[model samples]
Target: MKTDQSLRTVIVTRYILPLREGGSLPALTEADDDFKYVLKFRGAGHGVKMLISELIGGELARFLGLKIPELVFANLDENFGRTEADEEIQDLLKASTGLNLAMHFLSGAINFDPSVMKVDAETASKIVWLDTFLTNIDRTFRNTNMLIWNRELWLIDFGASLYFHHSWDGWEEKAKTPFLMIKDHVLLDKATELRKIDLEFKSKITPEILSSIINLIPDDWLHWRDTELSPEEIRTVYFEFLKIRLENSEIFVKAAEDARL
Candidate 1:
């Protein structure tokens, strides 16, 4: 996770606008550091589990040398958005008055359209490998949850990654499952070097990296309200799921390779 101390405690200073484009209605907000961010609320949709996915998937991508906006642990106060005219947004802010996830907004970034912007084979293959490993099924051509900034590809919106977390059951089995969704991936055709990229990435997801990423999820986000598992147990579940995913990578790697054919 991007645990730079400045990111440790960013208080949301002002609400700028509601990004209604997303189902969760993530907001454009300014922080104490005077920087604008796209804030993902903990109280929205899938709630904290979404944030957890964002953290792990994004940090894992960064570790593997993919470009992503800096993610910060944003703090929101109870009355932060009370003055907003929209009642729905007001209630959302009130409910999300604690820890949340935010990405440094990429000003002037354009949505990535493959027709307009071409990606190299290696980069496309790595992204295919990353999404397949992360189980992110949202990167189809329709959505293409990727952006272009300064002529570089920057990944965004990992909330859809780690889909298995939605149920919080059968996690171990889910980890080793084949990610058959790669066939619909926007870059799958361009990802010609899937096997090579898999070899380069499989060993990079070490236990230490897994532990470091899982440990970054906060206790509040770790709470599974429907389950009796404590935060520590929940953290262990995350670590174990990812550890097994790393060990059993061949399943998804082959799935991606076959999908390209």
Candidate 2:
């Protein structure tokens, strides 16, 4: 885990255009740092939890040494939305007048196609393990949220990964349950060695590392919802959930192995 650098905060200087690819309507934004990012708003229809999921999933991928774009906090000023002619985008910008999540945009990167690009067994296993561990239901052949940048595969758009957060009523039980969706993962066939990858990742992802990553989320994003749980308490829930998943990863690993057969 690279703990040397934390997520940087950049003010939104310009909202260039909308990507129109995903339902949330992420935009091509130029931040104060002069870098363009795919900005995910806090007030989008998907809500703040989606941002939380993106941050957690992307950071976890980074921790596992996978290729993921750098995530930053994009600060939106009140007048930032005035220039957008689209009413829907104007409304979206108006609602998201504060901190939002931004993924550093990779220019000229092509969508990953399995037939054209080959991934090694170990890399495939690690990616499959990650998607399975997080219960990410988005990375199938039809909608593989992956990119080929600089001749390497990069994981992107994790807002749909942690579906358990949408309804936390049975989160504990669901955390331990098998992620049956691994069978549809784009990299499942190439993940021939699950047990070895699981064991290696288990040792690397300690409780401390998880806590540190979870702590990176801003307080507003964590506590803004009308829930009784304080920001710290909510973070604790995530930590515990992840720890339990890591401890019982064998259940998920076996499921992935079975899916491979």
Candidate 3:
């Protein structure tokens, strides 16, 4: 969660175009700030929880010194959807006629190709550890979800990570659950120093940092029909779960190391 000083809110100025690659149907939108952003709708099939995951996952990456696009609170007016010719998009805009999440668009960025672009062992280890901590299942060889922008690798699309929140019945046990799918991570083969990376990060990510990151999530987004927990209570749950995971990161670190071998 970002501190109040770090969060920026922008109003949607124009709807540029739709990105058809993913199921969420994210749109390339222009904001009042005169900048382009990839807006993720709260009304998407994944619902507001997905936005929460995106907020946490992206901010966690930034906190760990990883490069990710800048995030903002985008305000979508009800009238913005009125001009859309597409019924589906109009419906989405209508449903999401409030605050949504947006990522600054990286113009002219290209998908990362591991064979052509070399990732050092240390960087790979850090990324792998981050993914393992978040239980991210989307950053595999098949869908990398990474881009080469300004000659640097940037992580994107974290709506699929932090999946434990989808089902809170046994979330405590699930937080410590082994991420078996990490074996297929795009950087797993190059992440040879998982223990070292884990050691470097374990202490840096304090409970305070986790709480701040979780705090960045808007209250409205945390309210879900599936559970009766209030927004603040839900934030506390995330903080506790992540703190427990940090304490138990050795398990995940060892798993990543074994997989690399």
Q: Per-prediction TM-score, please?
A: 0.96, 0.96, 0.96
Compared with the true structure, all predictions reach lDDT values of 0.89, 0.90, 0.89
What is the alpha-carbon lDDT for the whole of candidate 2?
A: 0.90
Question: In model 3, what is the error at residue 158, expressed in angstroms?
Answer: 1.2
What does candidate 2 score on TM?
0.96
At residue 89, what lDDT does model 3 achieve? Answer: 89
Against the true structure, candidate 1 reaches a TM-score of 0.96
- Model 1, residue 144: C-alpha shift (Å): 1.0
> Cα RMSD for candidate 3?
1.4
What does candidate 3's lDDT look like per residue over 113-218, in tens digits? 9879999998998899999899889888788999999999999989988889888888888778778889999999999888888889997987778877888888
List the RMSD of every prediction in angstroms. Answer: 2.0, 1.8, 1.4
Off by over 4 Å in 3: 1-5
Compose the digit string of candidate 1's lDDT tens values, residues 1-261: 333323356999999999998989999999999999999999899999899999998888888999999999999998788789998998899889899999999999999998889999999999999999889988989999899999999999889988887787789899999999889999999999987887888767777778788888888887776788988888888889877887898999899889888
Q: What value does the lDDT take at residue 224 in candidate 1? A: 76
Model 3: what TM-score?
0.96
**Alpha-carbon shift of residue 129 in model 1 (angstroms):** 0.6
In terms of lDDT, the poorest run of 10 residues in model 1 is 1-10
